[model samples]
Target: MNKQELIDAVAASTGESKASTGEGEGEALDAILEAVTSAVTRGEAVQLIAFGSFSTGACSERTGRNPSTGETITIPAAKTVKFTAGNSFKDAVNAA
Candidate 1:
């Protein structure tokens, strides 16, 4: 589901209100997301016990071919975000 749908579901599940400004499910989700983002951006892992962990990984510089021209090119190294689902999450998905 998209963000709005998520916000609605969260609100419904928690018996909270959805407001554009103060004390709402949307704001709470946004805050939680922002915290996770900030921590990951700082190269720290954010782990939620039954959900998953968000961490950073790296891709080394490598040679790649341009699809259209088939020309060899050097792909620069980059940082990447990685998510590993927890066992509970995996179990839920498997059950589903």
Candidate 2:
């Protein structure tokens, strides 16, 4: 679901007002994003129990073909983000 839907669901479940739920959710998401960016910038990992982990990794420079031109070019190495699903989440999905 999108942000509004999420806010509505949260408000409904918690008996909170939509504005308050939205504000809290937004602040929480912003904090999470900020923390992840900060950690990744430092080449570190962020883990959330029963959800997943976010980590930084490096990509090796490689040659790749351009689909339109069929010409090969170098792709520079860069940092990458990774997410690994938690067992609980995997199990829930599988059960579904």
Candidate 3:
């Protein structure tokens, strides 16, 4: 689901209003997201038990062929976010 949908779901689950969750200032869900994003952007890892972990990863620069023109192109190195699901999350998905 999208951001609004997620916010709605969390608000519902916590018996809070949508405005309280993320629509207004000092929103709880938004704060949580911001914390996670800030941590990841700093090359730090964020791990939530029974959910997953988010960490930074890297990709080396390399040469690749362009599918359209079949011409060689240089791909620059970049940082990436990685997520590894915990056992509980994996079990839930598998069960579903």
Candidate 4:
């Protein structure tokens, strides 16, 4: 579901007002975003249990021919982030 739906569900489940849930959710999300950003910037992994980890990898520079022009050009290496879903999360999705 979307962010608002998640906030509403949290507020309903905890018997809390939407304002409180929204504030709490926003803070929590900001923390997560900050942590992941910092880790990725340092070329580190950010892992969350029963969820997944975010990690970066490099793509080596290589030569690839253009599809249209057929001209070979060097492709620069870049960092990428990847996520591996946890077993528990996979199980929950499969069970559903």
Candidate 5:
């Protein structure tokens, strides 16, 4: 689901209006999202023990082939966000 759908679901489960659910900096969901984004952007890890973890990782420059013309290209190194689901999350998904 998208952000709005997630916000709706969280708000409903918490018995709060979507707007009120996200107070202070904005909405609760938006605030959480922003916090995670900022943390990842700064190369920090955000771990929600039983849920999962988000962290930044680096990719080394590599050679790759263009799909269309089969031309070789250089893939530049870049930072990336990685997520590893926690045991509970993995179990939940597997059970389904």
Candidate 6:
């Protein structure tokens, strides 16, 4: 589901009124997401029990070929985000 749908669901579950402009749960969700994003951007990990962990990883520079021209090119290394699901989350998905 999209962000609005998620906000509606959270508001419903918590008995909060959902404003047209997404005031209550939407703001809370946005704050939570912002916190997670800020932490990850700083090369720190964020772990939520029964959900997942977000961490940073690296890709080394490598040579690759262009698909169209078949010409060799150097691919620069970059930082990446990684997520590993918690066992409870895995179990829930498997059960579903």
Q: Which candidate number would show the highest TM-score if scored against the true structure?
A: 3
Candidate 3 residue 93 C-alpha distance from true site, Å = 0.4
Ranking by TM-score: 3, 1, 5, 6, 2, 4
Give a tens-digit lDDT track for model 1, residues 1-96.
988888777778777776642245557778888999999999999999999999999999999999999999999999999999999999999999
**Candidates 2 and 4: which is better by TM-score?**
2
Best by lDDT: 3
- Scored against the true structure, residue 73 in model 6 reaches a CA lDDT of 100
Candidate 5 lDDT score relative to the true structure = 0.88
Misplaced by over 4 Å in model 5 are: 22-25
| Candidate 2: regions farther than 4 A off | 24-26
For 1-96, candidate 2 gives per-residue lDDT tens digits of: 987787678779988787665665555445657889999789888888998888988899999999999999999999899899999999999999
Whole-model lDDT for model 2 versus the true structure? Answer: 0.82
lDDT, each prediction: 0.88, 0.82, 0.95, 0.82, 0.88, 0.88
Per-residue accuracy of model 6 over 37-96 as CA lDDT, tens digit each = 999999999999999999999999999999999999999999999999999999999999
How close is every model to the real structure, measured as TM-score? 0.92, 0.79, 0.94, 0.72, 0.90, 0.89
Local accuracy of candidate 4 as per-residue lDDT tens digits, 20-68: 6666555554565787999988988888899988898888999999999
Candidate achieving higher TM-score, 2 or 6: 6
lDDT per residue as tens, model 3, 39-86: 999989999999999999999999999999999999999998999999
C-alpha positional error of residue 48 in candidate 4 after TM-score superposition, expressed in Å: 0.8
Candidate 1: lDDT of 25? 50
Report the number of clashing residue pairs per model.
0, 0, 0, 0, 2, 0
Give the clashing pairs for model 5. 22-27, 22-28
Lowest summed lDDT window (length 10), candidate 5 = 20-29
